[model samples]
Target chain A: MDKKKINCLSSAISIHNLSKTYASGFVALNNIDLEIYHGEIFALLGPNGAGKTTLINIICGIVTPSEGTIMVDGHNTLTAFRAARSRIGLVPQELSTAAFESVLNTVNFSRGLFGKASNPTYIEKILRELSLWDKRHEKIVALSGGMKRRLLIAKALSHEPQILFLDEPSAGVDVKLRRDMWLMVRRLRENGVTIILTTHYIEEAEEMADRIGIINNGEIIMVENKAILMNKLGKKQLALTLQNPLSTLPSELEKFNLSFSDGGKVLIYTYDAQQEQTGIPELLQQLGEHGIDFKDLNTSESSLEDIFVSLVKEK
Target chain B: MNFYAIRAIYIFEMSRTWRTLMQSIASPILSTSLYFVVFGAAIGSRMGEIDGISYGAFIIPGLIMLSLLSESISNAAFGIYFPKFSGTLYEVLSAPISSLEIVMGYVGAAASKSIILGLLILMTAQLFVDYEIMHPLWMITFLILTSITFSLFGFIIGLWADDFQKLQIIPLMVVMPLTFLGGAFYSIDMLPEPWQTLTLFNPVVYLISGFRWSFYGIADVNVAISLGMIFGFMLLCLATIQWIFKTGYRLKT
Candidate 1:
């Protein structure tokens, strides 16, 4: 199965020069180019009204593109939409569902809607995986909000799509359910499904994403491996407590313009963690030469959330 | 072709009708029965015969058309409209099925329901007034054609409507009035002067006349003209649907 997927495709999804402009002249998405690989969990991070939903909608064929084209597994989303859409599934952000429909029937409806034949055994498998089998006979309106979110996942996976787009899957969900969703996502990746999700929860991406992409103001600012992003952009801070208070930094450290707090009783230095020369050694040597002594020294590294905040702030 | 997808939608919609049995089948049948009791049994008796057929029997086809048009429109309209109202339309729009298949599934189901309701009314009318079918096959044909035509129109109303009030505007304000004035209770011959000639302008007149001709072999308009008018209205509806899909008017952003 893995060999067949790569026989003719370079990437699972490829977007080129994509843009969407509403009739009201609102540019929902700018010229965007991106490539998503197979068997990888990619998380898209963005703030409110940042075009995350619009981008996901366009790729899923729910919204038409004003200009440019999208191909899903080498199939153009428009020209060969049947071939393209059959291999993809989308779990929308809204909790809008058939309030009167049974959970089992609605899931079956989605599978048939994607042109797949009936497979009760397979449907039962997904239902059990989402922990919805017990509530399968209940109407969707009877389930709790968390269960409805899980039902959306069951519907998306009903047809066994190769690529899944979950738009804010964890929104309004409890911690236990979020963890369960993350575990399910990882399991899907292991089975060779390419997953793309947009989330405001930095921890979700930090824990689940193999790669991360940050989008802001309708444009993608950066896309990098999760580990590489954290390391490259992660800033480390060194805090030193002085043995005696000083009026200010010595003349030799004036060029660095180091930050001092607590009435000059403490000194702080920040530098890139990944760089070979973080300037920490140079600063300490200069401090020793200047006779600036500290009784205590501690270092702190920034988390993924800090990096995300700084990146969005920069743009 | 996505026949499997089409079947799924068709079955889903049909099940909605089954779930709301009182509204879908019983309400229309009960109301049509009321018309038979008042007009076909009471007023129709004193009204006496016209063109050799009893007044009660003459209005049977017209009464069936009245319910057929309204039921077809509302069934198709509400079936699609509820999904939009509840935000479930996204799933249908994003599905791999084509627009044509979507129409077939919805319109097909609505028309089937209307035809069944029409036949049920026809049988119920027999209890109030005795009637004969001069052309049984043509009677069934008119039932099928009128149901399909009005169902397509209803689908358009569903797509165009944004609210519940808008959904009812066409069926209540437009279709019901037209049917009432389309000679549903009396033949155009009873009207005075140019009014009889002017009645041709009402499109419903053709539908009711063609259907009456199928029942009693008597009609105000020629059978061919009535058939042509029905086909014309259906084509206009089909063209409008094609334009809607092409522009992605209400379905897409």
Candidate 2:
């Protein structure tokens, strides 16, 4: 391949104004624009029925869109499907391996699906990496759920695609396997493979994603760097235990956006993390001046899940 | 579509079907044998010979037709339908393989199973009665043509079916009735004039009659007309299946 082509291949996938609507008049995906940077872990976060799978389907060329265009490594997905699909590997949400087929054959055949010649050494390495070498000759039906999930990953990576799409890779997986998958994903990214993942587990996205895109109602609500999204959208809470239970808040404490909780025994303050001078010290000083005292105090920062819920609810 | 991808899918389908190998290979052969014993031996003994061929040999073509028609449609339809119902079709559709590759892999396996069953019944028939072949080439031609035609029909049925019940509706309701009424057990010539004329509308009659002519060198209907009917049905099936693929009919939604 030419160097220019190789360079183009590194930039993986680009989508512009893509949309999909079923004939039943249900719009599964709205006009969505996204670009997955080369060699990065990009997480698509959405709740159920939010069009994450539909977006993946459009990118993989499995479902045709009603409008717009997608380019995989600069190859038009519609006209140059073979080339576009050859560069991308998709591990679908369903476990679809042939039940009677041996693990080795399943992965080897998936490699051949993209017109790749046999490379037993490469396949062996993939199986070994996925901890499937011991079960190489075992039929898929005999494998456990985690083993089946690993087999799906092995199959996807067999073709050595530049970009890999994992649609909810850990939906039903155990904690051990989920961690193993995260490690494997990190390794793949290190090897210069771009990964686009859709996940309902907020922590999975927070732990593994370099960037996060939130999709809702068939549209992308926001896409931001992990740090930036958290800093810009996250909130902080201050809890103050009072010396005495109060029936009502003091008018002076109104500036702290305070609320009573724990049967009026505690006062809570909510503030944006991105704002300078959260004014906690000033609030406490004012409370002391008012002859009010807190027996205990603590603060809690917002999590990715909180930000995600807020964003979805806002839309 | 690439040949490697086609081969991969073909091997996958064959592996999946291997679990029911006994049922797949034995059911049609056993049914054909029972037809020979009950219809050919018991019934034919009283009816005597027709067109100078023994009653036992007279029903050979019809028995083979029954196996070919039923096995061809069920094998193809069930093979595709199970994958779709089990959600494995999503894996296949998302793979790099094209629609043509998917069809070839499935239809090829279906045709292979139907041909094997057809040959198995033919061999079993040899143990009870011997049948002469006037045109060996035509015998193979009609067998393959019927298998392809019915396999294509089953493919369409598979695509159209959304549930397991719907998948079986075509074979149980349509195929079984058509095979019985299309003169699979007796010659249409034995029927009254009006019934014989109505039997001409049955597509399986043309297939069996053409195949019987290949074996006995004589048929109730003109061999040319039978061949034309079979070919016409094959073309219609091919056009419809191709349209389904092009439009991503049931496969997409």
Candidate 3:
């Protein structure tokens, strides 16, 4: 391989025009195009039936695609599955570890499955990182739900994969454990591992993702840098508390697109977040000039969830 | 198909089978003992000689076949089906192990169990009757071939079955009926002409006849014909199992 090929191989994952239709005629993925960098945390957000798992399944070589192709670490996923899969780790949605096996053996066996020679230290590190080292000798059936979930992460990372796919890692986890998982994900990224995560938790994406992909109905609606996406699509809100309640908006204040709320004691205005100026001062001045008095003022910005819902709705 | 990968899967499966050692070893031994007590002692006393051989000795081959067929099917079926039932099949499917490796591991384990059970029953039958192996080499060959054939059949049953109930259908509905009707207890020649000719269509007859021929040097059907049927069934099973692996039947989707 040449230098360019080596560079491409180091970037972790890429997918182009991938599609899958089940035997039952459900189109699980439709023309997905994506590229994941070597060390960034990428978040995939979608509704219940949005094909997140199917897409992951295709890239991992679990589900054969009806058309198109995917490349993992520059190796074609279908033609060079072993090499491709060796570099990618998958944490499946289902909690399906062997109940009769101990935690340590389960994770170690996963490493051996990848054709890697045994490395006790590597296994220990993974178990310790996932906070499962102490329970390593215990049978899987004896573990709590939270511990089982953590063990899944340990198993996925057992082979020291360059990229890890987490499918709703925190779906049923308590808030504290969820935070711990996020921290572990960050540490993995710092070690030059790429992460692609799917979740219904918008806050998780907002807090962790460097890039966000919004999938709806088997299609990716948008993929953008998190900050830029927020700046471009996020809305800003301006609220003014009235010194006295009113029955309706002032006829002059209507020109500024201001609306009344809180029983007409507050005048609310929404505008683009990316604008050089929101024109909020002019609107407040107009409210004052129109004899609308305010006792206090507050401003807020739209959350990622708001942008997520609006983008999905737009699709 | 890598050697180490095959070894890993084989060893794992063997360990799993060994975990239920008591059931696999004891159940067949105990069942065969009942056959010896009820059929060989009580029934054979009145039945007299069969083809100049003691009635107790005549039933040995059939009893061994019964044990082989039952254990082979259960081992293979439970090996694959339970993994799927517990959702661990997904783990195996997702691993770097190829379909061939998975099949070989499971079928190999099942065949081993069948051979062990067959051998144990043969040894236990000796305690009841003074049976002799007419052709030791043929006996070993038939034992191995039947074990592999039946184990593969069990694998197909595992892949086709969707639930625990579906898994049981083959062992109970198909295997049991065929074994009983296939002349495990009596020679087909003893049946009325029509039933004798009709019994020819049952595949289990070929296996039992071939095994009995190895033991007594006498068979209802030509030994070559029995061997051909066994190999044919073995090939059919291999092809079906290979197809199952290639298409991801029941394992995927």
Candidate 4:
């Protein structure tokens, strides 16, 4: 049996031991394995130079991998590349388009290149969905940055691919545009199109991804359901403003490992936010028993941004 | 195998020719006419026939070969290079179409454009002086073969070039010089001694000779050798292209 040739029984994309080493000997991706299930919005979260685009390009067939086996929709990326590629469409991070070609013509060209029959109605639908139908006849050079981005999405969706990759789709997008793009992504997912988007924006992933995969320094550090990941990695901080400044803390309250700042004006305790017993009430009672009194108290829960920053910073 | 993809690329490239009609189709005809006037009407009328064919008519095929070579190279080179430069080639590279299909689309369109331009120049030659294509079918064959072969060569240049200047280097510096010296304006047989043997090493000589043979049934080299040279060059280009896709050359990294 060939260990490298693993079956993708249920994975939309199954990557096994993927690694890409460029001619310069720089390892862009190293010993990575990931699986994206069908009909889900999977956000690949990573920072600058984090191999997000390299991974997307490899899966999309633009960049070849030095070592790995990638199966796209049950087709091997190397041996059955045509089948694999036909099933996927990629909206690259760069804003590349033909300046002289019209918007509609470019979409039609993309569909044809992907071996799809010409469908004017489908092209029009995607264009209109992306708010590009009105500018269809205009030369791409005349379009604004936002319209051009929309045109890229239109072209990617032109072929009705089973899997779509959006590499930093929201790089230069506005709030409204981003909202609309997400709406369209939702519509695609509703139609059973698997979407794997790469974004450094934690908010984008938090709002859209069903599952989140955090990649850092050419490796995937974590993959989990969005809610479970946030809950697990997130932190909660309890801050207490003392009624009086204290020169020192009593050893009875030391068990909580609490720290004081602002000249002992505030005491802080950090704990896992996801745990059923956060020890918050016990800590408060212990402080009370230790004769520590606070005038007011506040609590803060970490966002996905904090989790992402901590993850990358740790790596 | 993807006929639709091939048609799409071919139509896209052909439309570009239409958009730049002045530069693509018209300019070549205007330049070839100048060649017929200076080299044909001016010089040929003052000179005697070579191999019993009039000097003006003798240079017709060579003159067309000159433009065909340069046009085929530049057209295909620019067709692929511009996409690479502008970064739009990612879609095509990521598309399901095979490497062979992409080559067929680009080289096919470039050859078709050169063939049209070559035929137009052949027609323009009629206004200058009288001539006859002794083997009309062979004339079409030579025109097509040369266009396709040179277009394949140009596709290699496109893949090899990283910058716009590099793209022009082969067409302007290398191919142009070769065609001019490869018996386009004069017969290599007219050369003296080892120079004539040296001229045979220029592959363009065979192309021009074979193209001229189709016109006047006179050739400096055997027609079979000319065909072999063009086919041989074409096979090399094809193999290079295959290696390019296999290695993920400039197109991938």
Candidate 5:
């Protein structure tokens, strides 16, 4: 293999032709081929039951795929399961813990499950980082929801895995926990760990992901650099505040796709921002010709949320 | 063999036993002691001796075996089942540990609990009746073998069951009834005609007869055949577990 091929082969994870069909005949994933680069944060964006969890479970070896192969750092997941699995850590979507177990012991036990020796200092560091050191001796049943979620993260990072998958990390979490989780995720990324997270939270992907892959109905519809995707698909909205509130949009401005908002005090025109001509100039000229006067005007570029909605809605 | 991983699971499970000391350890011991008091002290004294051994002494091994079977299955089954129920099995599944290690961890801890419970019940039984082990080494062998075998059986039940009620069904409905009919309380020799032939077909008879023989130097069946039966059952359970892991039956998709 050439140098570039070697580099691709050395990627954190490479999945080829992966597919899964449940016993009940539901196709959860279909021919998914993906390469996650080392030391990069990759976000899988999908709707509910879009096969995000299925794909992650397959790679984690918790769910068997009906067909295809997966390699983690050049080890085949099926044939070299232990080696492949040793490199990965999965924080599942479920908020599960051994209810009677102390937090410290639980996390320590998780580290040992990966064959790591007991390192109390390292375990302490993780506990402190997650702000769980104070509750280390408490049973899991006594912890609040947010604390339990953090404990899950502590357990995932206990063995210091190179590749981490956070399945819906922010689901049902309070804002503070979500903020802390993102901060910790960024810190992990900075330390050269490859992070893969699945979420329907567009802003999360916009803030944390370097690349975004959109999955829908057991298929990868698109994968692109986060910046490129937003720039390419994002739209711009031109909002004009009218001097007089109109009961309805006049047919004279029908050439422009304009809509009335805020009791007709605002005229909103949405256009593709990526186009060389956004139709703003023509809309303005037409508005002047129609004798429509505006007291104030503002232009806003579409957010990642808008781009994500348009992409999914297009399907 | 990933001893650390095995130790991790084993210790976690063992700690759970400690956390539920009353239910896991005390309850079985207390229940078995009641059997000794009711059957051994009150009824056995009136029933006279069997095969030159006191009736109270005769029932000791069978009573211990009874508790051993039920406790082993329940402990092992519940240990693995709870992880599955709570979704924590995903962590173990995704870890670097192998199937053998997983089995050893859970089955080992569960067998240890049953053995300890069996021993405690023996100590409790001594308070009411005097029973001696004719072959102390063989007695320990049978005790360990029974615990491990039934623990393996329970592990399968844990995997096969999708709900809590299903977990209890086999132990309560199947194993318990089989143990009662397996000559635990009475020897097969006391049965008349075809009943003796039919009792031989019950697998638990061999387990109880073999266990009782280890206590009194006498058995309802040949000692070799009884050992063979238990070992055969062990192999069967082991094979079933191996297949379950290979096909990723309930553990996987």
Candidate 6:
């Protein structure tokens, strides 16, 4: 293959113009176009019912798309389902395990399902990485919720898929499990496996993702590099507690996008973080010229959560 | 043809049977034995004979068919339904195996279990009465064919049904009644003209009659017709499953 062809094929997953309208006439996804580079952690951040699971399920081939096409490792997902699916692993959102089967056997069975030869050593390594090795002989029903979630991850990785999708992996878990999950995700990325996770947790995306995609109402609103998105959309707010309450803003302050609240006891100004200058000095000089004295002032930078809510609310 | 995937699913299903031995194996055996004690010994002694064969020997094949049909459907249905209910079916669906492999694994395991139970009932029936097998090869052929056909039927039911009640409704209300009225314990031949004609419409009658003929060399339907009916039913089940997989019926969307 040529270098360009190899680079295009190197994409772990590529989706184009994908849409799904369920049988009940509910459109779960609009036309979506995305490309996930190999060996990167991509987090799909969306609120509940934003078609996050629907999109993930389509990529994993669990759900069929009504239109468009998807490719995994350059193989068409629908036409070459087996080849495409062999490269992808999905840890579904729900917690489901064979209660009667032992952990070791379940993982082995999952590996065999992908037409992979038995590799006891690889299986052992996965179980150990997930800290499920000690409970290998125990039935899944006997494990706690955290352990069962970990087991789901183990099963997804059983076939050693190049691309792993963790759908809401930390939906309802303790702090310790969340920590362990991210740690394991990092370890996997170090080994060059592409990871795609869907989550409602903004902090998880901020902490783990190289790129973030925000979905809302069956449409992907934005996709950008985490650092770039933060720098571009991050907003800082400056709030001032006035010594004397004002009935209204002065005509001189009309040029500034300022707002008064708490019956004019406080004044607030918002500015973009990525601007060459915040214009804080100009704001203070204008405030002094207007004879608006403040008791105290504070500045705070908005987190990703704030940006996400405003983006969704804008739609 | 992913034999490894098929073997994995088959072994997983078979292991479930061993886990629920009392319910899957023991219960059916004990229930079939009770049928033998009540129908074969108690009723046969007073009923004289059916055709040229003694009443005790005559009901043996019918009784085995009764258990075989019900057990085959219930076993296959439950085997597939539990995975769907528990949400573990996604793992199998997302795997690299084809739909045909999945059906073969599930139906094959269910049919094997039913066949083993059917043969065990045959051995147990011998303790109650001496039954002659006029064509042993035919008997074996019918046993396997009936187990597989009914197992496939059960697999379809498992996919179509959305709840536990739907699962039980067909086998309990429909299958058991048909088995009883299909000449399991008595020949349809003895019934009056209208009743006999009505009984022939019941598909289970063909199965029981064919199996009984294998034992006593007598039949209510021709042996060739019986075999044809079974193959026809098997083909129907296969077609339905193929459509289900292709359309992504309940499993995909």
What would the per-residue lDDT of candidate 6 be over residues A1-315, giving only the tens digit for each residue?
122433454678889999999999999999999988888888999889999999998888789999999999899999998999999889999998999899999999999898888899999999999999999999999999999999999999999998999999998888888988999999888888899999988899999998889999899999888877877899999999999988788787777789888999999999987888888899899889989899999998889999899899999
Sliding window of 10 residues with minimal summed lDDT for model 1 chain A:
A1-10
Q: Of models 3 and 5, which has the larger DockQ? A: 5
Give lDDT per model, in order: 0.91, 0.85, 0.85, 0.91, 0.90, 0.91
Every model's DockQ, to 2 decimals? 0.81, 0.51, 0.54, 0.82, 0.85, 0.81
Question: Measured with DockQ on alpha carbons, how good is candidate 5?
Answer: 0.85
Per-residue CA lDDT of candidate 5, range B69-168, in tens?
9999999999999999988889899999999999999999999999999889988888999988888888889999999999999999999999999999
By DockQ, who's the top model here? Answer: 5
Residues A285-310, model 1: lDDT tens digits: 99999888999999999988999899
The C-alpha RMSD of each candidate to the native structure, in angstroms, is 2.8, 3.5, 3.1, 3.5, 2.7, 2.7
Better of 4 and 5 by TM-score: 5
lDDT of 2 by residue, A121-228 (tens): 999999999999999999999999889989989988999998999999997899998999999999898888999999999999999998899999999999888877
> In DockQ, how does model 4 score against the reference complex?
0.82
Which lDDT value does model 3 have at A223?
83
* Predicted candidate 4 versus true structure: per-residue lDDT over B59-117, tens digit per residue: 89889999999999999999999999999999999999899999999999999999999
Query: Residue B173 of model 5: what lDDT?
Result: 98
The predicted structure with the larger DockQ, 1 or 4, is 4
Ranking by DockQ: 5, 4, 1, 6, 3, 2
lDDT of 6: 0.91
Error of 3 at B16 (Å): 2.4
Interface RMSD of each: 0.8, 1.8, 1.9, 0.7, 0.8, 0.8
Per-residue lDDT for A285 in model 4? 89
**lDDT value for model 1:** 0.91
Candidate 4 deviant stretches above 4 angstroms: A1-9, A241-251, A259-266, A286-295
Chain A TM per candidate, in order of listing: 0.91, 0.94, 0.94, 0.92, 0.93, 0.92
C-alpha lDDT of residue B215 in model 5: 89
